[model samples]
Target: MDPEILKFKILVLGDSGTGKTSIVRRIIRDEFSLVHSATVGVDFSVKVLNIAQGLEIRLQLWDLAGQDRFNHLSRLYYKQASGVLLVCDETKPDSLDSIVKWKGELDARLQYKIPAVLLVNKTDLIDDEDEGFSEDDLEKICSRLRIGSWSRTSAKDGFGVNECIKALVWDILSDKESKTPDPLTKTKDVFDWDDDCSSSIIRLGRQDLDLANSRGRARKCCH
Candidate 1:
């Protein structure tokens, strides 16, 4: 018999009201919430996907709370994360501004490099010329941060959300084969501290570390 396929953990990080929860709900449960409620701590769900080559994979998605006080709790979820869905609300420019911080937190706590997909959520809200951010802006941001993959999604309409998740999963699995290195071993090499490059990477690393430490303390408090 073939060995059991390993399960991959994908973390969703973004500012509050960015629709991180909505995307997850739409994908996992085929549900969407018109009245948004802040996620108290963290929410989780799982889905099985079949990729190319008949590879069956289980994705354990952890959705972290985007509030400032709950930010510290994110580190615990990142420990063994295989990938991240960094979400930003396309309708709100301020949420886009916080993307740098969210990405940094993931890098520091996990201390490992993982495939990241920047998701510009609420695409359905784009009203003609009123859309604040453009596809070009997203490309520039991702290029600067070395986040090569990205997608525009509308959880309300279920547009491009599933495709984004599948694409991310495939990318992660593909990287896994090429690197042939454990997640922890691959972290340092993935992030480079270059002054010429955008400061986004460094910011992400520091925030991740801080959140990780904070989560550790929180765990102790629980016990």
Candidate 2:
């Protein structure tokens, strides 16, 4: 018997040139485009992920435009969001500052906080000899924003891309399980965290079903 499939919307919000689109492409298609143009409004792609094995989740990834001109339309995309990836470019210090605005807009439009993970992108640009954003600094920011988890990723090389998806998806599932009224069903919630790599390895969230990833055509909007 086939298990019921659930649909979820994951919003990727960040400033211009923060590699929001690249992150999505890396996770969904495992491909990255260096010459990708800036998003005019909102561009989105779809991917169906099999969780544990029993639960199938359709992730509608919405990459919102970062330009101020398109800010007025942000509310339309924030509706019914299941999770959020608040992205920022690690090499560009200014990109970190822009995260505040993105979060502010999300709060104003959604009127409530949704489960989110902060993606510090472009980690490859940082010097291997030098450190960027100390652990204390990152902890302070995440704590202030109430982020569930964070990862240092390199969309260009696919360093932490898989971790990003796993973390956010786990949060979404945990959130849903807490709200579920059925006490008969048990949620498999055991996961191991790698502090050095800052990623999660889910071991027990298994199901008796087939898992697959679907590549769906995406729609782009230009203003």
Candidate 3:
């Protein structure tokens, strides 16, 4: 049996009502609901996978609230992420435009540069008459930002969702192999909780790891 790999963190970011949570739930549970309440501060899930390299990796995926009120809280989650999934609603042009700002925020807050994947979600909602954007437009935007890869998906229909994540995991692992010193091997001390219930808190790093593992399994199974 392969030694279990330490979990890696992946942040999912997008504007409000962009189906970030829906995509995650579909991948994690193989189930989807019409009603998914807005993420309060932050939420996470975990999945584990046994891949081709004799590696068992834990993927911790983080879903940060996209409301403006939570904008200030994003950096706290972005600080030590291993990768980022920048999701956009395919039906909303402005949501797509917001990727530029998201990229800037990641650059400013992260300690180390991390790979990013762009997901144009809700493709199922697009109509034949809607010609304002195309795969070419998304490609140009991703190329400009140097995103690792881009996927056009419909979270509602489960199209391209799995392929996008699998590509991301492969890219992350490949990037680690190409580096001189493995960037992801470093681990920090776990968080210490306060004795008082009112002061209790969960560590963001731990949440990140749990989500990555869960997302990784969703990807593998989807494939």
Best by lDDT: 2
Better of 2 and 3 by TM-score: 2
Give the per-residue lDDT digits (tens) of candidate 3, residues 1-223. Answer: 5454756788998888889999788667656789779999888987565433234567788998888898878767886688888999877889989999888788888766788888878877766635435656766787787787777677787777766666666667656756847453322222222234221122122233221232122111111
TM-score comparison, 1 vs 2, better candidate: 2
Instruction: Assess candidate 3 and give its lDDT.
Output: 0.68
lDDT of 3 at 223: 15
Determine which window of 10 residues in candidate 2 has minimal summed lDDT.
Answer: 214-223
Q: Please rank every candidate by lDDT, starting with the best.
A: 2, 1, 3
- Give the poorly placed runs of model 3, Cα more than 4 Å off: 129-132, 180-223
Indicate the residue-level lDDT of 88 in model 3: 90
Model 2 off-target regions past 4 Å?
129-131, 183-186, 189-223
lDDT by residue (1-223, candidate 1, tens digit) is 3423658899998998889999998878767879877888999898764322223457888998888888667658788899888899888998877988887777778766888777788978876654557656776777766564667778998766765675566567667867775553333332222344432111112223211122111000100
What TM-score goes with each of the models?
Answer: 0.75, 0.81, 0.77
What's the residue-level lDDT of 75 in candidate 2?
70
Full ranking by TM-score: 2, 3, 1
Of candidates 3 and 2, the better by lDDT: 2
In model 1, the runs with Cα more than 4 Å from the true position are 1-4, 50-54, 181-223
What is the Cα-based lDDT of residue 223 in candidate 1?
5
